[model samples]
Every structure is written in structure tokens, then in C-alpha cells.
Target: MSSSIEDRLRDAMAARAQAVQDEGPPPPLPLPRRSFLVLHARWTAPIAVAAAIVTLVAGVAVAVRDGVPQRPVAVAPAAALTPPFYVAAIVTDHTVVSKTVTATTSTRAPLGVYDSRTGRRTAELPVLVDSQVAGLGDGRTFFLAGRERKDAPLRFHRITLTPDGKIGGMFALPRRDDLRTETLDALAASPDGLKLAYSVNTRKPGRKGEVRVLDVVAEKVRRWHTDRPGFVDEVTWAGNARTLVFSWQRVEQEIGRETRLLDTSAASRDLLSAKPVTGRTTFFAARPGGSSFLTQEGGGKGIPPLVEFSTTTGQPLRRRIMREWFSPQAFDSSGRVLLGIVRGGGLARLDGERLTLIEMPELPQGERVYLETVW
Candidate 1:
């Protein structure tokens, strides 16, 4: 019996591979190895009492819903689709900016940009030592964190470059020793380009980690707590300039683990709470208008699939089972998401319904792409 099953599985895989080759690169194989075997076992089960009970229940539910056969609704392709965003290495005379590094390297990461109409690559900005980069639409700015040494002192710099690659202006961040370094996690520019939001991490023994938001425009900051031990995963800027949507984890002695959302607005100075039914949500990328986000629901083995969710409604938007671990890298202005599926020692996009497996291009060997926003 086992031999027969193995033969069938092999045949099925061969057919799929042939289909994909004929059509271009295929999507990741539909099922992982272990999942395919478990599904096969269930299919081979004898028709018995338990199966009858399940069938009866399903039939009743369908029948009671008015005789109209129920079917899952297909989502429409995103309206006003934006051009695909591309990753490129900036050619620069600066030595530090030219060298490339792996995705894991925090220092000297590559800068990513997206144009408005044509969605063309405008200009690649050079990243300096200890410099942090963030985008507000077409304009890209780099921030330099201050150093601890007495002679060097803590300082910050902002590099503004024109679309044609001309240097525009430079500024500095306020310097202070008391300011905690670990507290800083991510920096984001509001869609309008008037304000900036910084995700700061704070850790205290016996208490949950805290991520605070600092309003760069107003020069004010507020602190919030999360039960997650490390830093908050990512800080996403909503379409509306006033609101910021963020995720944090909470550990419960009785319940095991829980994840929650904090919708904060600068106008009201309030943080509203919304709970997602999915477990241990890892936020990847948000839609252009910030109405929704692409998220991964489960981890390890036997978990819920990766999915997209509407931030406003807290509803399950779409789902597909990824046979292996993957992280959402970015979302283009259109609703298409770029995911980094782990294979070997590198990462590449397992394009969904449209594009096929696209190997990320090689930059200077060590260089990495630090994605901020797709738009």
C-alpha cells in the first residue's frame, strides 16, 4: 500500500513540474512533503460512520441557506494598479555606499525607491556609516545616529537628493546622550510628507517590551507597552496622515500567546485596541492606502496559512498555504505583494498568481535591500 501511494505522489509531482515548465516557472509546489502524505492518508480512509456524520452536517448547512449553492467570492484585482517596484544598487563614488552586503547585515544596506507615474527608478541614494534610511514617496532621506565617543559625539544627518540624482539638502537629528539607542526600531514618513513616525523599543526586566511613537514634526513622543520580548516587528504608516497601525505580542499564562493591534491617531492622542483571530501574526507589508496588510498567521508545524487581512474590518482577506517559512518583503503600489521564501542560504520572491519564481538580483556580494514602502 505504501509503495502504491509513493508511486502516485511521484507521478503527480512529475505532471506538475511539466505543466510549470511549459508555462514559465511554476508556483511553489502546492503541498509540502509531509502535508501531501497526511492528505493522502485521509483520502485512503474507508467510507465509515464518522464520514457520514460530517457529510450530513455539511449538507444541512448548505440546504438551510436557501437552496442557492454557496461559493467563495473571488476578490477583484486591485483598482488603479501601480507599476511594479524594482530593486537596484546605486552606483556611487563613495566607497561605503558601493559595496553590497547580505540581507542579514544591518550596516551599509541598499536603498529602495519607487516613482509615481511611470514608476521608474529615479535615483539611488548613497547610505553613509551609521546612517538610517526612510522614504516619503519620491523623496528619500538618510538619517545618521550619533556616536558615544567623546570626540565623535552623538549626531544625525539627513541627505536629500533630486530625482535626477542631484544632492538637494542635508540636516541633523537632535543629539542627546540620555536618549536610548535600543529604543529605536523603525522610521516612517506619512503619505503627505509633513510628519514622521519612529518606532522605539524599550525593555525592562520582568515586564513586557515597550514600543513608543515619537512625532518628529511636533518633537513629542509617547510610550506604549507590548508583551512581546524583543522589538515590535514593523511600524506601518496608514494612508491617513494622522493614524499609525502597529502590531505587538502578549503572553498569557493561561492562554499561551496572543497578538493585538494598536490603531493610534495623532489628532485624538488615543490608542484603540483590536484583536485578530489569527495566532502570532507577523506583519509584512500594508496596502498603499493603508486599508489592509499582508500577514503570516502561523509558524512552526500544523499552523494556519499565510493571509491578507483588512485592517478596518479585522476580517480574513485572502489565504494560501506556504509550504515553508516566508516573510513578506514589500507590496507594490498595486496590491501585489513580494514575499521572501527561504531556500538554501538566500531569499527570492515566490510570485503569486502573476509572476513566477524571480531570483533577487546580485548586488555587491554583501549589499542588502532595506525595503521601506512599496509606493
Candidate 2:
């Protein structure tokens, strides 16, 4: 019976092999007790399908664990990524003379006389009112203008100091009625100290205000006629004291200002109007011997925070976005600029490209530093 059974099984296996050979080559035999033991089963097609599904699942899991993505990261806007700048030391101080007080007012406001070389306060003068003052390069003489009395005329005075911090001279200016209805805005002295520029504003009942310029050396006065009424913000001597660069704006509830460059020798006024595209602009220092003036441009979006332009050509020289409240106070002989940067309660100096902290030494417990011209 066993032989009969074995013969039957062998004959069945032989018949299967013959059928497979008739079709093509016989299928490869997978060896048992090896890595491919399960592949030898008759259900090899189903086992291969299961293995392919498992491999795909494992690949997806690895990608998720490693946090790999199919796309790239986006970039941010340039303007939003820009950093802020702080001021360092101002190089305008070339000398410091002495540390002395010649006079002190009842209000305790000492008139400080500074020597640019030594960076010292040489003398101080006491005056009645808080006056608008201008210093002469000689470091001894000063020009002050303010209201004389409650309803009286505006008075101009010349105060001079001796070498020993003594009051050398104090004289009143010539009485003038033209300045009665107007306010004094700016005063600039010529480099030679022989000439001075005075800007005054006058108010009319029903018309725009008028601004006039007086040349003390030439003893001449000229009125600037504009479509808008405004005050002269600044007056600066250009190349040779013959040309003057000034800035003014129409006074309204809304601040729209314009800066102009005037040539007293030409007898024709050259106007550079800052369009109302931006907000109110404050004129700072004008570059010596150049037609360009530095201005702080405020208001509107996408506009630079600071800009320097040629008042004659209306060409922009340099534009940068630095701080909100700051101005170009002075420039050294080497062309380095001294900037006054106001942050919170204190002011600092931005010298060239460095930031230097400043402390006011006059007031009691008052360490606030402001802007002043050195030389």
C-alpha cells in the first residue's frame, strides 16, 4: 500500500513539472530553512504583494519622523529686516578753552562760553530773558535778540567778554519798527565775522505772512514773496557769504514746509520747494562750501528718515533711514558729520558712524545733552 501511495505522489509531481515545462521554463525552487523559506509556498504571489505594501509604509514613516519637506522656505521683506543705528562720538570738538562762569542769571541759566579746542566752558553771562543767541567765532562776542518788554519792540544786543571773563561791552541795536510785527527765526554770522544774516517773519491781517532777510554788513533788506505764508526755519551762509541757503514753510493746521536757496548777489530768488508728498521737514545744517543741505524728512510711508539735498539743484545727495527724532548738528573740518539723536529722555551724538553718549553738566541732577555748534 505504501509503495502504491509513493508512486502516485511521484507521478503527480512529474505531471506538474511537465505541464510547467510545456508552457516555458519551470519556476525557480526556493530553498526551505533559508531566508526565502516562505517564498517556496504555493501562495508566493500574495506574499510578495504584502511585502511591497510594508516597504512603502515604512518609507513614509521615516520621512515623517525626520521632518523632511518637499518645498522650500520663503524670504522676508528687506525693509522689515533692517536694524536700527545709534550715535557715537561727535568729532566737532576741536578745542576746549576754560571752565569758568562769568555771569549767572536769577533763573540759574548760565550763559556758557565754550572754547572748541579745549572743550571747556570759559565764561558765562547773565541776562534777564531767555534770548535767542548766536556766537561769534572769536569766542568773545555774542549776539542776542528777544522781546524788550511786554508789548514793546524786539531788541538786539551785542555782549562781549574780556579775556579774564569780564563784561567788555553791552550795546543795544538800532531801534527798528519793521521787526515789531514779526518774529526772529534765525541768525548766522559770516565766516569772516564782518557780516551777519537775520531772518524775520511778519504777519498780515488777511494775507500770508512775509519773511525778510537783512544783511548787516551790506545794510540791505530783501523780502521773500511766496504763495504761502511761513517762517524761515534756518539760514546758512553758502560759499562766500554772498549766497544764502534757507528753509521755510507755510504755517497751517497741517504742516507742509518748503526749503529754498537764495542768492543775494543774483538779485533773483531761486526757490526749492519741498512738495507736500511728505510731511513737515526740519532743515538741519548745510554743508560748508556746497549747495547741499541736510534735512530730516518726516511723514508718509516708504520715505527715508533722513536725506541730504542740494537746495540749488534740488538733487538728493544721500538718503538714509536712521531714527525718528534726530538732526545733523555740525560737521568737522574733515567732513565728518555730528548728529544729534534723541532717544527717550536723553540725547546722544552720532559722530560719523559711531555712537557716543552725552551728558549735560549744568543743571542739578540734570544729565540731558542737546545740540550745539562747536566751531
Candidate 3:
């Protein structure tokens, strides 16, 4: 062979070797089973490629640049995420009586603690008048709001639970005279228990809706007001305590409902300045210390009820809900158990795709209603 031709062939081989080095090694392969080589020879290559593909698809990672040190993604192990064992339920009843043109009304809400596994009421607190309740991420600390009657000032209290799921203590929050007249439509506590965020709208004509974030320890508050006469509901916090997700609806305009994300870290006080996360959502619930949240779609007969969504993009993360499950209210720490209300005034737990109706005892007669539940 000519010297020039030999040199060209050698250079071509060297270029091909460098190209292979640039494309890093293949993804780690799955461990092989006990099948010996006697089973099949030709199938080995195809099976190995299939295993590599599975590894690549299942593993999501960020691209690593040369000499850049990236922190390893910390994924909470399934074993560490424990299912909630105790549940705090708010039970309420309203009655009205009319006697020969004279009418009277009464309202009462009783906070009850139940064994989540057995659906048995372990303890009950005395009735709280016209009350609303929200739980801190710790699963034991809760906040309760109550009022004497319609158009009356509201009072706030902090509730603690014993290890056995009984009421441990109840203490009143430092009163702010400005908050007495405002009605709390929705409330959520930060995962770290450092702050409380709530939406208050009186619904009086020409009044705008407002959202407030109060620093629990500091007792300082920051307010955000809507541009128009609107109200916010279903207020929930993302795992990163700074972001809040809620549904906004303007009463003056016919713009329907919009799910919005508000960053409390920002200085702006205008609520509308926050961006919309999803389109016209009626309800959504966030998992404690989780990066995802659950949102539901309306249905009549054949539609799936719940969809897990990424809190960052408001995009559906997974779709594995059964047709029977509906109105998801809370999620266990590991997000494996979804607690929701089902037909006939009972609670249901959705573990994976299987739905189990909790065996609950009958409540005391006299028109009972289940308002809310949390763990």
C-alpha cells in the first residue's frame, strides 16, 4: 500500500475512537437472573439493550458540564414516608325552626379526632360556633377559627394533639383587632410552621378580596389585595414555603375562575400581579412537604376525579385515579394514601388505585354533616 493511503486510514480510525469517547458509557444495566447461557445466545444482545433503555427512561437527571460539581438529587425514600394514622375531622350541623311566623337558627361545629385506620372517633371537643379549621404540616398542630353568629367577629385559636390523637391543648392566637371583622374563606399553614396564609373576603358590595401572610413567631403580616371585587379560595402552600397556590374569581367580571400562584417573597401587594398557574380550577390540594399537588376535574359518570400535578409548572404529573375516588382532601406524608370524602357522608382512602371505604360508626342523630377532614 502507498504511504499516503496508509496514513489516511490510520487518521480515520483515530477520529472514530475519539467520537466513541465523547459519547459516555451506556447507562447501568439491570442485574441478570439465574438463567445460564444455555437458555439462549441470540437473545442476550436484545435483552441487554432493553434493560439499558429502561434505565435511561426511569432516571431523570440534569446534564453535567465539565468540571462543574452538581449536588445529588435527594429523593425521599418510600419507606420514610409514613402513612397518617390519626385524622382530625370537623363535624357541623345547622338547624332552623319556625313557630307561627317566628323563626330561629342555630349553628355548631365540633372538632373530633378519629383513628384513621379504623374510622373510630377517639375524642371530641366541645362545639365551636361557626368554625373553620386548618392543620399545620406536623399533623398534630392545627388552627381553628370561630364566630358567635352571622356578621359577628371571629376568634382564632391554636390546637395541639396528644400522641394518642386526643386534644392536647387549645390556646388563643394573639388577637389583631383588624382581623375580627374579616371572614377567613381559606387557610393554610407553611410546612415549616413558620407562617400562616389565609384569604378573607366579606362579599360586601364594592369590596376587594384580600390575602394575608402572617409570620407566626414575629407576629408581622404582609397583605395582598385584588384589583377588582374578587375572592380567593382553596389556598394551599407549596413544599417551598414561599409559594402559595389558590383559586381566584372576580365578582365584577365574568372571567370565570383561575388558579394562581403568588410568591410571598415579592414586595408587590397587588394580588393580580401573581401569575396564573392553571386554567379555571375549582379545587386543588397540596401534599405536605411534597413537590406536587392534586387537582380535580368535573365529572358526571365516566370521568376520572383526581390528577396529580407538578407544583412548579401546574402540569399533570401522573394519572392513576380510579373512577370511584372523588374530592381528595388530604395526602399522607409519603403521598401514598389519599383521603377523600365519598358518597353517603363517609370517608374513603385511595391507596394507589384501590379505594377503600372507611368503616365509620353512625354519628349522633339530629342532622349531622361532615365539613372538612385533615391529618
Give the candidate number with the greatest TM-score: 3
Best of the candidates, lDDT: 3
> How do these models rank on lDDT, best leading?
3, 2, 1
Ranking by TM-score: 3, 2, 1
Better of 1 and 3 by TM-score: 3
Residue 50 shift from truth in candidate 3, angstroms: 38
**Which stretch of 10 consecutive residues in model 3 shows the poorest summed lDDT?**
56-65
TM-score of 2: 0.52
Error of 2 at 195 (Å): 3.4
Which parts of model 1 have CA positions greater than 4 angstroms off?
1-132, 136-178, 203-208, 226-230, 241-243, 249-259, 266-277, 300-305, 321-326, 334-352, 356-375
Measured against the true structure, the TM-scores of the candidates, in listed sequence, are 0.49, 0.52, 0.65
Clashes of each: 7, 16, 0
Candidate 3 per-residue lDDT over residues 1-375, each given as its tens digit: 566875675565555544543544323334455574455454555455444444443332222235343343555544333233344544556556666554434343466767655667777755544456677634577777666566556566777888776788988777542555566777777777677788888647766688888787887778899668778866888778888887887787766577777888888989988877653344677777787778776444664557677777766677654666467776664456666777656777676666777655455455666646766
Worst 10 residues of 1 by lDDT: 86-95
**Candidate 3, RMSD to the unseen true structure:** 10.4
Which one wins by TM-score: 2 or 3?
3
**Candidate 2 local lDDT, 158-247, one digit each (tens):** 777766535579787664334555556567655544455666655563234344545555655666555655666667665455666666
Give per-model CA RMSD: 18.4, 26.0, 10.4
